[model samples]
Target chain A: MEPSDLAGMALIAVAGPEDALAFVSSGASSSAALEQEMNAVLNDSGVPRWPGLAAALLRWRPRLTDLAPERDLRVVERLGGQLLVPEDPEWPVALSELELNEPIALWVRGRALVIPEQKRCIALVGSRDSTSYGANVAMEMAATLVQRGFTIVSGGAYGIDAQAHRGAIGAATGRQFLPTLAIMAGGVDRFYPTGNEDLLRAVAENGAIVAEVPPGANPTRYRFLQRNRLIAALCEVTVVVEARWRSGALSTAHHADGLSRTVAAVPGSVYSANSAGCHRLLREGSAVCVTDAADVAELAGAPGTQLTPEQLGAPAVHDGLGVEDLMLLDALPLRSVTSVDKLTIVAGIGATAVLAGLGRLELLGLAERANSGWKRRC
Target chain B: MEPSDLAGMALIAVAGPEDALAFVSSGASSSAALEQEMNAVLNDSGVPRWPGLAAALLRWRPRLTDLAPERDLRVVERLGGQLLVPEDPEWPVALSELELNEPIALWVRGRALVIPEQKRCIALVGSRDSTSYGANVAMEMAATLVQRGFTIVSGGAYGIDAQAHRGAIGAATGRQFLPTLAIMAGGVDRFYPTGNEDLLRAVAENGAIVAEVPPGANPTRYRFLQRNRLIAALCEVTVVVEARWRSGALSTAHHADGLSRTVAAVPGSVYSANSAGCHRLLREGSAVCVTDAADVAELAGAPGTQLTPEQLGAPAVHDGLGVEDLMLLDALPLRSVTSVDKLTIVAGIGATAVLAGLGRLELLGLAERANSGWKRRC
Candidate 1:
């Protein structure tokens, strides 16, 4: 190898496989020329096979060094992290399908996981300035998502992002490994924001904290936006709670949409400016409106579709009423609300019988007072 | 006509025009039937149409000591002030379309009016126990609706109901006549809640207030449900802001739905127990989702297709920055925070150039900074 090639290889050794891909892609030099000029004469002679390889190689220049491949594995042994190249059987081809923002290489730590096994994974994203309403929704969605055996994925930021991770941890608090994954903008080793240092540590210890940047690399605004595509590519669904019209959480939603992942959002009061982003998503059909954990679970229908018999939580049906009460309730719905006298009029009974039936059903909670009349209750 | 004919006429009048048509088609008792036969036939008829003549004749019976058609008008005038019978073209046909709940005769005060005019009108109904969120929406919708020359229709009751009337009044607070209407359950003289007496009086003086019952009659629960159907029929649209799972507001929405009027509801926090009815309406597709007056107006579309240039208001489009900004704005969205540097990278422009353009756009009030990321503003 030339001295420069050797130096690039050493940098790859230190920067890891993924960093090498980014460096090469950034250089945009070499004109994607092969290590040798052998293909030049073949291409001049119009050899279709050589041109195809040449075009693909040059075309791959952008995504290639994102993972920064090393021609030799011996150098990879020096770094604690291992290289995941395109040729690796376990390397997710799904991510490569992300097109421009696709990772050229993945610098993974701990267990090298497979994407398909995490099919139920969901990305939770939202405003950095989340309100109590947004936070509650994020936490609820996260908790229920994890409870269903779905892995939760999110950026380890403050506001809705932090709550989402916390909710996932709360869901799997006592489990062996956290079913929650937190992606960071900076290097995996350096936790950014210091505020979430403890939370990120828990995430790293229990679940994986994946990043495309090299170790010790400080995350720039550029890198974080780049990292978001991975979150979108990895998850089956992405949910947003609260965001301003300019929140980055929306970018995650956009990434999810581009990746054909289900995007869900919690709706907020129209009066709240914080919920404007979520409303916009719903209006433009960018995200399905979600209410609770079950709602999110229903939309994604992730791997954790199963519900234990104990957790089946059924709603109470008002079937225990007497025949007379049932008749009254039935008559009441004949019109959505009925005055006692009208119930008598519609039921073809006396006022006495109608009043008695209503009194009984009200006791059973099968009906409620509506304005001056009565309406059947769920 | 035979004395027996008087009895049949009374029943037929009570049955109303639609029921009268049905009565005639079904070969039921004629208006000339004897009092006993009329009573038996009216009781047996399953149809809910009112026989107006019957109420008029019944009222005159005490003075006549015999059935007399001439005394009917006096009886009507005495029972509830002046009766605006259906025969009077000044009477709104909107009430007759409620089918079963249709009143035999309406007693109205203030300036007379006809519906399906050049004006757009909407009914706002919800719980008497409305949350602050619901009340605020009611106010905005009514004020905006009234200002747009759309008459506001609502029950003269408490909570959301009261707010609707108040908002309409506030919109044109000191105008010659506020563009607001109130439909009451009882006699016009007997304001049901009594607390809204002044508002109801203002509605009558400014726009309209109508009652289906006799002048001296008090409102029964039966009357309120019956009143809801009329409210639904009179307006072009009905909106339910906040309601319980089983609420009078839901009934009003259903009545509007049945009438084929545009029905909409403002959504609220799912965490709120009060918003359950609105959520239920959205889930069941009983109402279209609406957050503000413009949405309701746009969907309902100014009552008629031909709007003058002045009435059409602002076109939906904003200033310059056409398709590309819209596409990019749509592409990035607003949940996850996306850095400006990343946006330039994605859009394939130098960071400095993109920042300049974004700043210019921001000065134009089309972009907002959220967590240091830029996004298009609505």
Candidate 2:
């Protein structure tokens, strides 16, 4: 094993990310060097110990000595994933913003290209038991955002998170870009909530499944709470679709707020208990109310920046139409034919005006007469 | 006729509240005096014309000469209401806060006690075509506020406004105190939307029906918009229960914001088109999100100040019960008897604990045995 791999594995075995941060800040290059410095500090009465440093070193010394770096690497490789250390190019720089609380290392499954720059990612999260309103909104927002060249990041749970990934995958047709990521509370090798195994595998094929723990680790309640911080850290903006009071999604928003990232929430009915946390956040001035994708995009500072005509593989149409023609075209049915009477009512124009407008539209090849009524041409 | 009444009547006949304010602020207190001053201003090039003053005075000069204060007073008296000038003690001082746009006078029905001090009043306004959810919320909030010593103020329209007045009246039993005021766009004598005439009569008996225009005036679209300002100015806080885009309630909120008063909006489902304006207000930071009467009360600066036990005509009961006993008492049926199993489930307590709680509650005379189980005592 490489010396740096030995140091990373030893740090993970002995202590959490905070301990590794402390060791790095102390200018120690390896686990052996860190141990020597920590022991000297513990022995000297004159030296001031870092907070929790002495106890952490004492607790981790035996585990550090027993850690098998080679075996851990083999496990990660056998799972068809890679372990990313701080020095790796694929490591997200946004995680470093967590400072001492940053993950010691990330166990990642999927192509390395799936890791997005901090600015191109957005976190969409909400209640595990979301309402249909929430799920629809999450899916629509995720699809719209992915089509606009944004990669969605979220906890890989049921309801909103699953819908968000599904929406992004639906938008990823014929595209080489990574569109979504599922940040897991447990090891990526064994997808937690085995019901979502198929969905997670699909995500791994197109984007990534990421975790802070090693392979085969089971998810725990505490790990879920800790996992939220990584989602908040990875994205530039975190939007909560719906959450009941004191939901874990609120913890993610709080984390995003602590990170000075934009936090937004979609509002729901006051009668709905599911929307309580979002209303509380809006009431307390902790989160901005976002109603749609355009709202989220504008708040994230990328207004009107959707997929280009070239990216969409279609030339921009309808620009040459007059205002009245545009209105008539919009009122025309795209599938089933629409009668002129219906068009006039829908377009709020007189019958004579509608007939005239339809003629112009027909001349422009935007509309065509069917067996019974006028229809929009593809 | 009294000269002051002539001046007031002439101002009403000539122009709107804005013109009346200009004439009064010119330091001319009578019709003849104001006519002379306006003529002088029109004749002099040095004096600046108040924005539409010239055109208004010219347009109304003939009508002002033809005005009859005695006929107007008789009209007011015939309707069984009073015409209140600024000199009247019952005149709402909060309306004066509007400055140049304050009403020339108010046509008021019912006892004088209904007009509240600025700090003791809150305006509840919303879409005239409110949903059941909006109406329910408005009614509950109105009832809660009236019980807490606040006089509910609102427009006398259907939907949310009618429900607000109804809720306030429901809470006004046994108390001679007028707990509500319904502000009208037209005369209080002939309620517009004759469908609500019965509700208006009930409001006048228990509280007040007020209008900016004279008894014979019809409610025009412009007058409705103008009347919203009076509702906004007469209260300390204006809460919009539910509103569609471009609703008059939004105009009221804007007026409240212009006055630097607290503006709050109840959040509802984004799917409900009626809630669009309210969500817009929240997103634009023009209003805070309010879910219940407690939220409104706290924002209006009087929290937890509900009706006293004496005012409620009963000494407070169930205060001395243990937490579980109180919960069990609450779970007990008020009208019908409920079984112990139901109580246990409702209170989420063990059956044994529920039986013990029931014993304690019965001892306190809060609950009594019925044919099948226990019922709450009146």
Candidate 3:
């Protein structure tokens, strides 16, 4: 193509290297065509694009370069309807994987995403088969990290990992805005565990949900270990929440040390089997001793002054989620359904939002207009 | 003095080369008495001594020939205790305190006073506030070392140290007779931490209790750390049982490492505050890691082979300590007074043997005979 022909490309720009690669591979010269082709690729890849994606892409064009559009578009499509790339202004650079097995793209729908470039963004990792003792300790440390204004990063797995993310996200403090970054091994569509879907969704909506693998990709054991290295690399420190003697947590610690990052370990009872890996790390000199997130933040060279709850960050603040609203949402039929007063008694949302919310839901495509009043559609 | 008189005089030994100057100043002949007077002078000087003392007269001995001795018995007395003659079979020439703060003379005791020439002895040490886990581990390693026939050595404190002594003393194989030694900070007579008094007595009876300080000296905190170098010097391997962040155990470990002795440590729970010192040692590369006694024994180069109970050279195997005998021993009055009826009820021994045993006990100086009956002297 001539240099003059390359000038025909309109507004929105992409800066991500992966998006650049995807655009070049699609053989599209214009941003609009590139986006449509990217969406096609997502459909081909078995992921769905969001409804307002084209409009959102156009708004992001003035804010980002040509490559940013492709990457952000792919991210939203891959995450399904749960997450949307709300803006380019509040995104985490720490979640950006640099080349080697990078995150194909990031899918986030949080209130804020503020991962500072110069500051350390550590991810505390450990086994899903964590002991109760480990889980409690992970929670305490995550809370402490958030209180100290250190963004708590982790894999959003069950056990210790889940406790860590929950701690940072639930902390009343507002300093933990985009501080919590969850690097999942699987795709970003919905919660993988189903039990933790609400938790994962909370994290994505509050902080950020990140993945190196694209959406619809299932997390494999190998990917789990590979993702650990990312956890170590993105932050100045990596903490092992709890690990068995032969656990992937040890691998993450080793990766942190290899990257010249500080590796901290929480000690456990001498008899606790969950602490064996940490003991091994402590014995091997691969990890520093840490009792709380403050220790980690200190190791990361962050001063340990604690932030107030309001100062910590506003990640989990939902605009309108109440008990009645949830009860109504849960009452909806799993499959498409019909009937209004019958649904009202079961939903308990009353006549007010039920009428208004149904229209809003219909507009959102979550509910479709049907025979009687309306039918719920997933 | 005549030339023949000079020939008749034994070689005068000064505490050090500088010590002779005092002898000359005292107007004593440069004979053995001169050395005695000089030692008395030096002992009264209030100068402190350090461990690993080989000798103190560094090339200055020849400059003080004008010294003199006055009496012959004083000459023998001076040479007997103050000087260790190489011709004396009790001398262990292989024990060298090179480059370490050298001693004027080592106060020696025990069977043979034999130090292995060109062989190595390793020191194992750790916390007095040890967990049961650390003690058991220390014992196993001691037993293993005994099997390998390396001399097991340690401080005679409670916890790991006491266990080490017991393990070494209980060596069944007799592969290395008189296999254990305890180095004390205080005088060998005043064992600190009274709980270990019985164990110390057993150690004294089974092996040896050594101290660099003079007899009847109380142990100060400084002296405990001061004597650590001797532990390091006497052994080729040092095992740490368990220690808090700040304990005497780390001092011994550091000394052993400085002296180039092999240092090993038992790994403990990461969460335990007591094992923090051990963890720190492991972190600093001051000690190798060991899980069990076998691991430590292997590090100590101790031998272990299956030896039947019969093959074990137990001093004089007695059946499980009989309750009746213990009662008899316990029944002895505070003073030397006892009645036959009391003896019968106490011992439950037959009339013949009770008398015979009493007679034997009397002979052994453990009992005394009075016109009324018999009583325990001890």
Best by TM-score: 2
**Measured with DockQ on alpha carbons, how good is candidate 2?**
0.11
**Top DockQ prediction, candidate number:** 1
Each candidate's fnat, listed in order, reads 0.11, 0.22, 0.08
- Output the TM-score of candidate 1: 0.65
TM-score of each: 0.65, 0.70, 0.57
The candidates score, on chain A by TM-score, as follows: 0.64, 0.68, 0.57
What lDDT is reached at residue A114 by model 2? 42
What ordering of candidates by DockQ runs from best to worst? 1, 2, 3
Model 1 C-alpha lDDT per residue in residues A17-116, reported as the tens digit of each score: 5654554557544433332333443444344343232233333342332332342233333433454655688776667556434555555543324333
Q: What is the i-RMS of every prediction?
A: 11.8, 18.7, 45.3
Ranking by lDDT: 2, 1, 3
Name the better of 2 and 3 by DockQ: 2
* Error in Å for residue B94 of model 1: 6.2
Indicate the residue-level lDDT of A218 in model 2: 51
**CAPRI quality of model 3:** incorrect
Tens-place lDDT digits, model 3, residues B1-378: 111111111112334334434533444433545445444434444323311111112111222242233342243234232224334565444334423233323443343245443244656688888888777767877776676666777889988899888887787344446567787776554657688888877766666666665444456444566678777776767877788776778888887787677787666654566676776676556777655455555565656633333323343211233333333445567575887555653343334445656665666566787787878775
